[model samples]
Structures are given as C-alpha cells and as structure tokens.
Target: MDFNENFVLGCSAIGAGLAVIAGIGPGVGQGIAAGHGAAAVGRNPGARSEIMSTMLLGQAVAETTGLYGLLVAMLLLFVKPLVG
Candidate 1:
C-alpha cells in the first residue's frame, strides 16, 4: 500500500518473530521442572502423587508463556493494529 503501511507490516513481522522466541523459555523451564520432579520422585517413591501434581501444575503454569507468545504472534500477524 503506502510506505507507512509497508513499514508497519515489516516491523510487525519482526516483532512477531521476537515474540515467538518467548516459547523457548517455557520449553526449557518445563523440561527442567520435569527432570527435577522425576528425580524427586525417584528419591522418594512414597511422595510420587504429590510430586506429580506439583510438577503438572508447574508445567501448566510454565506453558502459559508459550501460549501467550503464540497469541501475540497471531495478533501481530492477523490484527495488523499498527498498519491500520
């Protein structure tokens, strides 16, 4: 369309790319949490239920970051707020 529109679209694409990077943190965090949880359960088999529940909860919380990143990327690509 116009120069400003083109610039906004380009910037939005870059920003969306950056936003998707947020998924990395949650992936790492969840992996570490799962590893630690498994270790903890191995150390104390009797506490397996507690460890599992806590690990699942923590993983769910950590997953929100990735979900947020996806949402942001979707909005940036589809909404085109700045371009408008």
Candidate 2:
C-alpha cells in the first residue's frame, strides 16, 4: 500500500480506539446507578419493585452510549470511509 493508504488506516485505527473510549462513561454511569438503586431498595424494601424498574430503565438508557461507541468503532474499523 502507498503512504496515503497507510496513513488513513492508522488514523482510522486511532479514531476507533477513541470511539471505544466512549463506552467507559456508560459503564461508570450504570455502576453508579445500580449502586444507588441498591441503596434505595435497602432503605425502603417496600419499594423494591419501583426502584428496580427505574434502575433497569436507567441502565437500559445508559447502555445506549456504549452501544453507539461500539457501532462507531465497528464502522471506523471495517467501513474504512476514508480509504475509498
């Protein structure tokens, strides 16, 4: 391959790495949310169902960030938009 092709591939790899870093935020967020939810349930066992539902919903929402990051990384690594 030529220098330009190599450069594009290298940049794409770097971009995919950066994109994957986005997953960290969602993981931390979900952990914190789960911890708080557990604490909330412990404080009020009568509300366990409510707390669990809310926690699960929030976790599902938070998970989207990681999913988006994965999608971007896959696209960057496999699609190679800059190559063609």
Candidate 3:
C-alpha cells in the first residue's frame, strides 16, 4: 500500500484502540451495579422487582460509554476517510 494508505490504516487502528479505551468506564460501572444488585437481592429477596429494575436502569446507563466505543470502532471500520 501507499504511504498515505498505510497512514490512514494506522490511524484507523489507533482510533479503534482509543475508542476501546472508553469501554473501561462502562465495564467498571456495570460491575459495580451488578454487585449492588446482587447485594440488594441477597439482603431482601422480597424486593426483587425493585432491585432488578434499578439494576437494569443502572446497567443501561453504564452501557452508553461502551456503545460509544462500539460506534467509534464501527465508524473506523466502515466510514474510513480514505475510500475516496
């Protein structure tokens, strides 16, 4: 490949790496949320509905960062700048 093409490919790889880094927040947050949910369930089995709802909500919020990373990765792979 030409120098420019190689550079663009390198940048795309770098972009993917950077985007994946964003996943850390969501991963940690999701883990925390899961732990809380499990604790809550263990503490009060009767509140399972509430605990589950809250857990799902928190998990959904936490997932946004990872989704953003996925979006960036998809953009890098499919919408590359060098296609022209």
Per-model TM values vs. the true structure? 0.80, 0.84, 0.85
Question: Could you tell me the lDDT of residue 60 within candidate 3?
Answer: 99
Instruction: Kindly report which residue pairs in candidate 1 clash with one another.
Output: none
Candidate 2, residues 1-84, lDDT tens digits: the string is 556788899999999999999989999999999999999999999999999999999999999989999999999899988786
* lDDT tens per residue, model 1, 1-84: 457778889999999999999999999999999999999999999999999999999999999989999899999999987787
Q: Per TM-score, what order, best first?
A: 3, 2, 1
Best model number under TM-score: 3
What's the true lDDT of residue 34 in model 2? Answer: 98
Cα-lDDT of candidate 3: 0.87
lDDT of 3 by residue, 1-84 (tens): 556677888789788888888889998999999998999999999999999998999899879989999898888877886544
TM-score of 3: 0.85
Candidate 3 clashing pairs, residues 3+ apart or interchain: none
